[model samples]
Target: MKVSCLIFFLFFSLFAVAQTTPTPKKKLVVVNSYTQYRAAIKSNPNNELVEIKKAIPGISLDIRYATKNNFMQQVMYKQARAFARKPVVESLKKIQKELNKKGYGLKIFDGYRPYAITVEFYKKASDKNFVANPAKGSKHNRGCAVDLTLINLKTGKELEMPTPYDSFSAAAAAKYEKVSPEAKKNRNFLISIMAKYRMNVLENEWWHYDFADWKNYDLMDIPFEKL
Candidate 1:
């Protein structure tokens, strides 16, 4: 009878432990976003991409940024990635889902850039005294702007567009390449998807889009890990 009681106590203790100890949390893994663009060797090493499966629980890294042109593989503002807030990530995921249904994906150019990176960009812009107004507000800083084009997932090829991203010339004009049927189709398609979300093009740069409510977001420098 004493032996039976001992076994029963042991069983109850085990059950209590199972009930009290917390389950192991699902882990999220992500590579730093700026690490690749800063290298800019022209070889887009895919290792740096944020994996959705390893990121937030129940959320997968949406691979909308992958493109085909090989030439369109431009990375921008290494320090600018806005993983600081959950709303920002959710917004991008939603856009990814919508674009996927349209047979295209969002090719990310830049996101969540540090203010210091913006300082570097501003200096090069020949204006703003090398200090971003902190008011004009870069899209990446606001976690809303993304430089991308229509990418066909099946072929893993970016649809022909007006010009390469971040090209500082007339070639970058949205309607400049009107002669190429493929370019026009690609350009129009990009604009259409952005419009659905009330996003607007940067005008000079065809590939850049900014969400209309950008003012609501504050400039943040949260590291990618904290996201």
Candidate 2:
């Protein structure tokens, strides 16, 4: 009887140890093409969050409403609440100051997109031939990407960029040679500020740039209302 009791306790002890051991977390499945995701504001109207230029010094947006017909957006506009990402917003303020000295204003087209908005963008990217995949995690999904450009605040007009935001054609290319010098100057101002701040531009789009520290952020889906 004593031997049996001892053996039962030992078995119980082993079972408890096994139960205490934690199971490993599963690896997340990564999507294929979040790299090239941009949406037109028309399809994803979530870009209409209240603009807060003063929140970040030197930062201003030639917001669609701010400038009637001169607004620009991505083909896959994932509604990011960049206002929610204050650090990024603040960075834009610094960037705004840098560009202001050169007679330019940082007109943000998009920022801090909501997760549901990103999912919407993913669906748009799923359309073959016209767009690519947003299934992979997007830099925008990370809430560290910005769709923006330098605007001539004085003219109340958007500066000449190589291509309009989300242009799928060759005109969107950073080095599209046929672009005008004024456009190049505008593009250079954006590039210089971004480079100084360690931001990287998307190859096909002129107004897109992802912060270098993007990997540090988790994919966010927080909505504009929530922000």
Candidate 3:
């Protein structure tokens, strides 16, 4: 009986240690060095981050994160410029041309955000659901995502959507149905046009879209000044 009790305690102690052991965290690789980015572009020119405005002239830029108008209520980027992968900019150029024919134009809010900014957003955002977790990084950090809205070219006024940019509500959803008929029509039209250019709208945010081949790019931490 004494021997059996001692063996049981030893088995219980081993089980407790195994249960308390923590798993190792996964390591994330973020490209922060300009030299590294240059090397990547040298290997594949498609990896180059092209300035959207320069690539597609006449594209309007709001760049809210450069001002204090964003959800953070603080300036995140020093410059009000936006950029994306070479192919991404090309796709936008085509989308812009098509929209222009319809008297509409693309107004960009943000693009190619540094990975560090994403970490800041995850930490500061009150509604965590809308923000991307830093552990997985964001498509914007990969320079393959864009935040934008449609605007009437003649009036330069934004089209009425279900909700304003960065709204943390169910109405912000790309297909939310409880909105006005005009909003639904405008939102669906924007989504369809963006889809035609390989930009898929985010399920939660109608204004957010990820390039179809975003996974091909690496998460970047390079600042706007470097690019």
Tens-digit per-residue lDDT, 33-52, candidate 1: 45433342235322122422
| Candidate 3: tens digits of C-alpha lDDT, residues 1-227 | 99999999999999999999998888988999999999999999999999999988889999999999989999999999999999999999999999999999999999899999999999999999999999999999999999999999999999999999999999999889999999999999999999999999999999999999999999999999988
lDDT of each: 0.54, 0.60, 0.95
TM-scores, all models, native as reference: 0.57, 0.65, 0.89
* Global local distance difference test of model 1: 0.54
lDDT of 2 by residue, 24-131 (tens): 866544322222122322344333223345476445554331232322234333232234244455567677777777777876766665555555545655333323
Q: Total clashes, candidate 2?
A: 15
Candidate scoring better on lDDT of 2 and 3: 3
Better of 1 and 2 by lDDT: 2
Name model 3 segments beyond 4 Å from true: 1-25
**TM-score-better candidate, 2 vs 3:** 3
